[model samples]
Target: MKRLIAYIMLALSLAACKKQNVKDTGPTTVVTPPVTGIIDTSRTSWWQKAKFGMFIHWGVYSVPAGIYNGVDISDPGSGHYGSGEWIMHNLQIPVASYKEFAKQFNPTAYNPEEWVQLAKDAGMKYIVFTAKHHDGFAMYDTKYSDWNVVKATPYGKDVLRPLVDACRKYGLKIGIYYSQANDWINKGAANGGFWDVAQNGSMDDYIDKIAIPQVRELLSNYGDVLEIWWDIPDEMTTARAAKFSPVLALQPRTLTNNRLNQNWTGGDFDTPEQNITASSGGRPWESCMTMNDSWGYTKNDKNFKSSSTIIRNLIKVASLGGNYLLNVGPDANGKIPQPEISILKDLAGWMRINSESIYDTYASPFKFTPWGNATTKLTADGNTNIYLHIFNWPGGEKLHVPGVKNQLLSASMLANGKSVNGINDDTGITLDIPVGPVDNISSVIKMVVKGKLQVEVYEQGPEANGSFILSAAAADLHNPNGWDDIHVENEGNPNLGYWTNPWAYATWKIAVKTPGIYKVQAEIATEAGATVMVASVNGEAVQKTLTSTGGYGSYRLVTLGNLKIANSGSVTFTLAPDPGNWQPVNVRKVILTP
Candidate 1:
């Protein structure tokens, strides 16, 4: 998680981060009460069953909305701002000057009950709010530091207390997002992703003086906290991370993520930020993502994801046996952005009709689905309910569900009780699906199975007639949990692609029938400069130089000189970024012909 390389060039003077009116602040003091036991994860089943939650990133940065000194940093491609939450670090606003914004940070419209009710309506079971962000701005009352909402702002009230109370009243689990590392105001850790070369205090001092005390305060103050989400472990050493373990004992069932230290092995869960991990290997994880591109409120940030996108994403995470922590960045007035509110309301409508498809659901029992994500849950009668979330409703009545070998009891549209008939066979079941749009965003079809659900493994696709198309969807992604996997790419297409890292690649398996000198071609889309793709099969390889097809969807055909095939057997094909030409490439389909 070290972003120092990206920000090293943008680092500003340390004096630029201090304010003239800064009051003398004392070092944080902490007293860890005696705790004797390790955290028991028995109660975390509730979290796994919940499937969906809310993430709120609110702080003094919302006041600026990414503007400073008449310059707008929030605008995309501005290159002036990175994360809205880290604008202080990005823009180099001194602590003294940043504190002045506290005078205008009063969120008069803030109502905890309203927030909690909205979450409930959306079918979200939990709320993880920013108790303290990396700017070292505490939203709660902290006795360890005076740089908090209650101590510095005109609001002069603890924001977290009411939120905790309301969540408890509404029967929603609550969690505090504490940036345990990367404190902009703490000594040594304040260097913006890098170690401070001119630091005057030791990291141990910061850990003992601030982090432990603030964490202790949060755990003690919050009622039955469900999680303590720590962000950016760039500065957290193994020993420093151990300090929080004592305080974590206070909340036996409260979970922590794996970011305490970059490579720290101790955490209750994995937190994949902004993008879904391709695989978690059965470990509990959550994908925390922002509705828009920015995590915090930015005035001109209008890249809000559609309600349909949000619903599908939630289903995507839930179907993968992970939770979806969708984010909402409220404006400075304490009101959730109207776009975000409308999106939540729209999601509420979908949840009303399909919550059962999500809650307590297991991963799909099949290898893959062309329509969309699938979920399953056990019924009282010992039946397994398979929920097929149809993103692209197959036009025909026969919806092919491949590789399912379970006894089917019944199939019906979840939105309504309408029955759906299907033919069950060895390859899988093919349902005689009902016509018409069941739901605009996503339609859920519930299929009941007789016994323990099981699915056939994926077999190598046939290369009939001496030709085969290896789709990006079936490619072996280089970065398992990155944006390059099963998500929408530019050009409004779903494929394996990324515009940033040039070295990213995807491999595919092929059936080498009638192996010989086969003509190989690639259908690609790009939004960047010219690049080359090295297509290697077995031991033979060829490079194809490519030009941008304009956008991510504007794909063009490029031929890689014929590759020699040895014998007729299973073969491996790898498409990788041609070294030295670090440009973006999106390969949708790799075609091999004899």
Candidate 2:
């Protein structure tokens, strides 16, 4: 009882820990204000406390994997655009052709208990299965549409029912991801916005007949769903979004994503797909990413992210007050592949040691660090429990924590309960670390400090004239595949997003010492021309087209024009394509010069 009281008190005092002086930037930087009532409101979500979860994108697409009519999907000419899950639309397989997979969709090996047990063993708290993706193939037993699993498949059973039951049996929170729009079953699902099929129907009839009723069935039939993950609200309007409210009224506690309309109209949280979202105004957001390049099974694609990358991504998400919904694409036989299975085992090993740092914690109030990320859970007392997840551990006897004012009570390695000597001085707190990292993945340095945390956020670099060089390393690649050295994009091309996505973006959260219309110049080298690089301060943006540098990797620094800021604060620069289409470019860094 006393502990509960202490926890409440800690929660109340959490806002006081936000450092006013720091330049706010996430591992990948982009601070989007979350919608009201849905994002981090007075009523905290149980889903937020349950930090980690699983995202499964399964359907008839698993049967095709990547090939359709002997056409290689990797080739753009093959009409294969996006992930393996979208193979139906990408290959332009007629509705008649795509329906053939449903007949053969017999997951006789689909063991719900095994899948749930695997998730539990991986230390995942929840599961968000793709009950229905853009393909419009419903995995659940839906009475509204005959295009569902029970009627269409040879297995002739509700695939999702056993999974939901098993989740309940295993004490895991389960949610359903329903694609609100883009029902390829409706001929026009591939194209964005509204498309009418003369023979089949309009999107409106599809929604009224299939979408709304199916949602109602999901909430009513499923026992206590934590989330109703919605996707691709292309052409979704406010009125269309309103139709979902009745469905949500069935399950008031169930959270929805922001993509309910043209903008983030209806959602309990912002969903940053395949990338860590930069936390803003303390919003409740999550990053849904896949293990491999594709969300669903892809036979030819073997570019699976390492176990260490998965662990680090989790830390990065937690550090920014978001959940990590890692994905796995099961095969047509409903078995998770070997590489994905191995990665989950690795995650389980890591979580067993460091889940305390992840689950039930808000973003760290302290400033950012290049080495890694941080997360803080307020203790029963007013003291803050800070978890320093050292990803790029600099080999040194002493680890320096600059500009933090707090009374350090204890310091220990989470992996091993070995206590480390702490030294607090005017230079900030320095911990005496061992000769090597405690764990190769990410070593957690758990520090329990008394009272609220006081952290230094802004670091001023040496200015020459009126310009400052912002290192490429400091800029946050706010995408899912945004790593330190390499740029990662999970979709578009089977290889990555960078090559295929025209709207690829990276951000830099610059702590401007001099607030003015500083010249924004980017040191870049790429093979594309007529490409747009949009530089912006906050949301105010300016664009300029670029010609190719001498060649790929041939370098040149070009001025992207100027951006104006009102006062000395964190100025965000979003480097992305101009507007309509995906443009390609390789960026080193953006420098602000007067």
Candidate 3:
């Protein structure tokens, strides 16, 4: 009872802290006055607190449903496909033929209340629905264009109005996604290239006349547009992007993504699409990914990620201090597919049990952990609350948290509130966990630390045998070319793979106690020809030629000559690719033998 009270008090204090310096509108209502003067990061408090949101991608594309002329738009074998939403662009379908889809665009079964309720049940705090997709067909009643749901479709009503009302009724924030650029049906808008003669109009006129007016209606008609999602700023120059500023100024508190302009002017947060990017520079970011392969509904794209995958993805994003905007593509009938609904139901179950570990938690202090991820929250009494989301539970019932120097207060299972004990050592704290996991997907353990948190730097030290084993899992990846380009792959064993970028490298911090001459051996796998790799430590470096091992899955251990270490307490070992003669390889581990 006391612990629960402490948690409640901590949550209230954190809520107060999030709203401290931000502009106060009336009584914390959803709608606020238009943003005036300088807009700071405090405007993003609601969104930052909302760690998860639902992304809806519905449009005329659902009418065709990734199929055109009896061929799948994304059929790789036919060599004629892109995203389901870009079917018109990829097929270069004439406007006359594409406009025919609007005749069949009637979502008779779309219940706004049901949709909003699902999101709320799934623990999503907000919803970003597609008002207008790249197809240039609006899903709402737009006076600016006749190519809208009200005028063109059989169901002649504004879809967004009811959705907004439902959100307000259910206490879920509403957002609008408008394709600012690359409007396929609109004249004079950027359409990637001039595929059709009708698309050869001035881009500025489209922004000024159609785009800006539609944006104004979206912001005004909607009670409080909490988020304005701008997609594919292909030709959105600074001047053209600047034109939408005044319209957005009306809803000053609305959070805008980075896709508004090429320069990212007025963008409140970064939007990383389709992948979870590394974070911790303090800038707010959200990763928008689809449950399946396609953002829009594709009839054949049944490759939905499992409920476990979705839960883990959400946990991973929270651990990195970012939000996850999961996409759901409803069919033409306005019904979220049964599989998608099932996934959400499963997610709702998990969130019911383990959401406290996710909501309002900051990034983990530890760089990386093999078992799973961690999220932290500061308590009201200047202590720290750490949630250990264990994905891979230890078989021996011992969970080691390395490099933590903070004094442990209490540990408990998040699911059942059962007590868990911990022991602090020279390495870190180790918790004695239950024999079986509390939850099959992810079992969270809530831990409280006394006073301010403290952690030791993570460095691999020599074992009792006086030999150092630098595993790939412990290496800190340094890649300027984003997260997906070069990263740690977990096929069978976790190894640093997909190393195509020459500029990317991996570093492992080492603490050498008994320093002396050591023989180096590296476990690597490569399908390509011999590549030069430089392994450097303590100002001494050695170049090793990595020969092909027949296939990327095939692993081989090659010995690189010895190097003398005069004296060392802490040193960094960097394994970098030779840009001049580099071949893609997977590094499993590096071993030093005394």
lDDT by candidate, in order shown = 0.73, 0.72, 0.79
Tens-place lDDT digits, model 3, residues 1-594: 233223333433443333211111111112111111112356886677678999999999998988898879767775776678878877788888999998998899999999999999999999999999988988888889999999999999889899999999999999899999879888988457777887778888899889999999998887888888898788889888888889989988898887887654347766767666543234577889899888898888888888998888899888877889999999999999999999999999999988888887777766557788888887899998889998888889899886666789999999999999998876668999999898878899999988666665555668779888888766666544333445665623878888887767777666777778888888989987789777766556677788889898899998876867777775656677777778998889989887
**Model 2 per-residue lDDT tens digits across residues 78-193:** 65656888787666677778889898888888888988888998888999999999878899888876888889998888888899999999999898999887787844344453
State how far residue 223 of model 2 sits from its true place (Å): 1.5
Candidate 1 — which residues are off by over 4 angstroms?
Answer: 1-43, 193-201, 264-266, 476-491, 499-505, 509-513, 525-556, 560-584
List, residue by residue over 1-594, the lDDT tens digit for candidate 1. 022212221221221131011001111111111110111258667888888999999998899987888767766566775667877777777766777887899999999899989999999999999988887889999988888999888889998899999999999999889988777765656845433333346677878998899999898877788988988787687878888889999988898877787564457777766666543234577889888889988888888898988898899888767889999888788999999999999999999999999988876554346687788777788767889998888887778776666788899999988999987875668898877668877889999987656554343454547577777655544432333233334324556655454544555545555768878888878776667667666557777778778987688888978988887755556666655665776677788888
Tell me each candidate's TM-score. Answer: 0.84, 0.81, 0.84
RMSD (Cα, Å) for all candidates, in order, is: 12.4, 8.7, 10.4
The full ranking of all candidates by TM-score, starting with the best, is 1, 3, 2
| Clash count, predicted structure 1 | 4
Instruction: Mark the regions of model 2 whose C-alpha exceeds 4 Å error after superposition.
Output: 1-44, 74-81, 186-199, 463-467, 472-521, 525-545, 550-555, 559-586, 591-594
